[model samples]
Target: MKRSFSILSLLTQGTGLLALALALGGNPPARADENLFGFVRGAETLPKGHYDVYQTVTLRTGKDVGVYRGWDSDTEVEYGFTDKLQGSLSLVNRYIYNRGVEELDDTNHLTFGGFEGTTKYRILSPFKDPFGLAVRLETGWLLHDEVAGLLEHEIYVAPEIIVQKNFLDDTLITELNFGGEWAWGKDPAEQYYKEFSLQGGVGVTYRIAPKWFVGLEGHARGEWPLFNFNLFEHSVVYAGPAIHYATERWWVTLSYNYQIYGHGIDELPRTQTFAEETRHEIRFKVGFNF
Candidate 1:
């Protein structure tokens, strides 16, 4: 059944492409979302034929104790395929080392890549005026896991609706983007589970100069596990300020989100402790269009 659903995901993704190709038929370009550092939403204006690149390194402080050291890194590359279509690929690597252990009992590392595709449909053009509505559909596929043979792979299908309004001569723009995601995965224990995710946020951007702008944003995602991983359910939220620079074919963003707190765990049933840790991390990304 899990394999069947995976096949369905590919089939539905193809169907979405067909719908986009037919619906786009020379339609006007749609506006893009605006969370700079975290998962929040912003009222960002994007022109056709534009590209962006994002790169960032995050350091986790005090994650290590006298027994363990932890580090993680993620690299994502995304492109605007059209005025309303975007695609991305990401590589993530994580490491955990025993602080004072050796002899094949001290270190672990895992690396994986994810593929994603997204499409946006503008119900109304915000550029012509100030108020508009839009919808976005996206999906992702996680590659095979090397460390956890019991962990197969997972997929997510989500749809989001966004509303934007510009006030005070476009200097102050406010936006609300909210949506839900469905996730499914296979466990090495020959079990399958699914979950639902709720994502939403609000943000505003200010034009500091002709080509520069600064903005503040916040977003959160909550999930409830309903099968193999029922013990893994939590919510994560983040917020911060981001600076955006725009050019014809290239755009760059440098933003940071402070610890708003959330939660997740790779292993089930902690053997040493029973306290829930609030999820916190910083992410930096760059995007380009060609």
Candidate 2:
């Protein structure tokens, strides 16, 4: 069965709000320190005594035939606890649709993906230091069955280091992120497993106009086997372009990524020689700062 709601539908619904914001704007302010795109985190924290609220939507399609399609929406709230520290909370929802599953007649499911919390601290300021440096800790719980028909009861912890540099009067920006996730979970069949993954990303953006920025981002991820931690089960790389638009009160970003390379079990085993991996992804985010 086909679902009536989709990522496109969600974006369409928000068009009116975006138009309204555009109508009420002045020249966009200086760009924030956040990365323009990709999964990378930038080494900037919110200004003290400020709040940011945002929503993000992501769509992913499998590289292999007869795999799965996934859509996710996340709502997040963040507060600047101090000049050097920030905290955030997020709620996630997901939808998954399976293909080529002969055993199940109904191949689509929508469910709550669960919640996440994050804390970040800046160790060095780009304004004074050579580069911006920060560390972030994130944890999340997933108690839903929307992913691959798996009732995943998982707990995951991720730690990330963010580095940033700017040049030419802060018009040209660069960001780097290194992170890893450790997860333990029960699968759909009640099989318990532990997994570890490593990820890194780099992004560069140039402020072309006061309110507009364009950038390119690249990301790489590798999955390690549980028992034999030294061996990677698969690896993939993605690269794409991103655009950002911001006004004094609100901002929006859009990015698209396509897998450039894959190794080991990257596609589904039966469908291709590799395990299933994301072939393409699109992300959209809109936020307000107060």
Q: What lDDT does each candidate get?
A: 0.56, 0.77
After superposition, which runs of candidate 2 have C-alpha atoms over 4 Å from their true positions? 1-35, 101-106, 145-149, 189-192, 266-274
The sequence of per-residue lDDT tens digits that candidate 2 reaches over residues 58-136 is 8887645466677888999988888889999999898888777433334688888889999999999877788999999
| TM-score, model 1 to reference | 0.62
Q: Give candidate 1's root-mean-square deviation (CA, Å).
A: 16.6
Residue runs of model 1 more than 4 Å from their true location after superposition: 1-38, 41-110, 144-150, 186-192, 227-232, 261-279
Q: State model 1's lDDT.
A: 0.56
Model 1 over residues 1-290: C-alpha lDDT tens digits?
99999999999999999889879774544334433334454334344555444444443322213343334455655555655454545565555444442222444555453555566656665556558677777787755432221245678799998788877777666778999888777343223366677889877778888757788877777766663335555566667876777654445666555546655555334322111222234445445544
Model 1: worst 10 consecutive residues (lDDT sum): 270-279
What TM-score would every model get versus the actual structure?
Answer: 0.62, 0.81
Cα RMSD, each candidate:
16.6, 14.9
How does model 2 fare in lDDT? 0.77
